[model samples]
Target: MSSEFPTPGLKRKARKGGPDVPMWAARADLVKRGYEPKTVRLPYRLDEPDDAPLLSAACLRLQAEMLEWSSGHLRDPNRFDGTIRSLSRRYQTDPESPFNRRLKHTTREKDAHVLTLIEKAFGDRLVPSLKLADFWRWYDAAKKPKATGQPERVRRAWGIMKKLRELFAYGVAAELDGCARVRDILAEIRFPQPARRRVTLDLEHIEAFIPKAIEMGRISLALATAIQFDAVMRQKDVVGEWEPIPEGEALTGIVLNGRRWVNGLTWAGVVLDGVTRKATTKTGAMIAHDFSLCPHVQQVAAHVLPERRVGPLIVDEQQGRPYAGDAFQREWRKVARAAGIPDHIWNMDARAGAITEAEDAGADLDAIRATAAHTDAKTTARYSRGAVGKSRTVAELRLAHRAVKNSA
Candidate 1:
């Protein structure tokens, strides 16, 4: 074949083709040099003709290129095969697959953390051989013995396992197109049983701790005690802040009046600023309620100097900072010891005590739920058991009375 083409300076040159190349080969050569392929532009239409042949050819070319690359770069044949299998299973067609969407949902940090754990549990060499069984074995090893009273550790392990399982499922779905076998494998796994609900503190036990708090010269301890008794605020919330109620006046001398404290607002509520970053109640809710502050609480709040009013209501005088969760726990232990209460009467005990007291006081279920800010009624029901037991006693007495009358 011979071709005549104009050069940049408008000079024509006859170029001879080597060994009479085919038309298609020549066309490809032209395309390699940046010449556009000739095709008729179709008019806008709702239905388009199938381009399966062209698509198949393109895919074949891409597969060939990938194979060449993998042959050189991927030294491990097993890993390469696994990767190819995963890709095919996840997407019927890689170009339009949902793998990218799934990948986008996961963070690099989370993946790295999970991978580290997996690698540590199973040596690096065995990590590549990780199956669902390997994950379960790792989880079992991580769990503490049932007799250890380390239910929290077991729960943590379960959480980690669940997260890992989700990641695995996502990978299988996206990389293997969808792995029903993996899903079936995960379905058989069961989490460890959670700890039973143990109400560790009673009203009497908490009341005993107040004197010790007062004796320790911990001003905020008195407030915390009062809040725990009155509002069902968790330990974290009770100690977080002591905001002044709008148009509120501070409680004055305690001895002068039988009432321990009086606030401008009907209820001495904590002002919860949603924007602030801090630990919240387990339910992630805040409460503002009217409850009578204890006489000791009134006394302590009044005594604080004007300069120390900022930050959390509870403060460490030495640190000149608000007492954190750990600090509060430590103080609580000390207070419990001084009050002649068992060490089990920790901060959470106060919350449980409040719930028990409220139910005993004949507060309806709705009222208790509102105070606790529980998302589910089931949680509120847990606290209402004490109240239910008391009610059942009354009902049993009435039933016995009727039975005696009938026998007579």
Candidate 2:
């Protein structure tokens, strides 16, 4: 362990013939005790403002696991058997469980976080003795205003309750005792729903974002932004998604970073009519767009040599493969910051911006609905957040009608 660093309990090993800098890893005791990860290599030195928090988080997580292990919560079969913590493990590991087989990798990662919160909340509370009030109590506690003067995290608490409901359903299916009662109780209660998002990404943002992404050599990100804006597509449809590989199966798609990546828009999807046609991942409804009409998509497409247009439309030039997962958004945000886009707007907001722009341009709701492959116009209505622009469009149309009548 090094005394030079502020973070203690990390072991160091000198490189054989590599850099003079030593490789830092978790302490030997944590390794000996068999942490679930078994590997906690720190690539970051505590140099930047962000690095300190990252290192501190690893330390806190390691310490928490160690505390749980020593307190008999993890080690004692008699005290910990059939607890929420144990059930969560089964939910994660069972081959037939939705967590293992059915969930998207991104979803699994998110649920795993919620499950950790659930484990801490319930502790040794046996599923057989659980009550609905327990959940409500957790919800109430979760919604309390923070000491930092922050408002109650109602949305966050709502999400936790939603995941808890799913866990209860799993419990009932698995025949964990008392979950049926709590599940019934949950059915009687209504959870809160947050209002639709109002923030939007517009053309000015697109003009700024694309050129910066291109300058930074993140052409894939640039193209994805353009496609997402022009085509009104989800990031998943544009950049593809990562999924867990089945135990025994061969996939034709790119398999990197230990997951199978599939379903991104391929250059093959770009047809001779200059229209890019592909089925969306979520709704499975096909969307087609003429890239020739979108200058941003057209300009970025020129950067990719015609000879290199054979595979996934968006490839990470740095890795020489498609982005692993969520890395696209991470890199997109970096470009956004450098390009002077506001933090209030997100990469996901690109779709909303496009749709709002369409509404202002007087495009029909049904037409905009097809942009997202949405089944209903009313649903698309919620995402069209530009009231001022839409109002102006309406005003212009009314005055134009009056002028035409006068001329006639």
| TM-score of every candidate relative to the true structure | 0.54, 0.71
Worst 10 residues of 1 by lDDT: 1-10
Predicted model with the maximum lDDT? 2
Question: Per-residue lDDT of 101-210 in model 1, one digit per residue for the tens?
Answer: 44422243444465455435432221123457766776777676756654446765675676556544655644442244555566688877556556646667755666
| CA lDDT, every model vs. true structure | 0.49, 0.75
Model 2 agreement with the true structure over 267-385: per-residue lDDT tens digits: 88775238778888877888888777887788888888889888888888878888886677788889999999988899999999998888888787888898679998888998899
Q: So what's the TM-score on candidate 1?
A: 0.54
Count of backbone clashes for each model? 7, 0
After superposition, candidate 1 runs with Cα above 4 Å error: 1-119, 122-132, 145-153, 169-184, 241-286, 293-311, 384-408
Model 2, CA-based lDDT? 0.75
Segments in model 2 whose C-alpha atoms lie over 4 Å from true places: 1-82, 86-102, 128-133, 143-152, 173-175, 388-408
Question: Model 1, residue 104: what's the lDDT?
Answer: 28
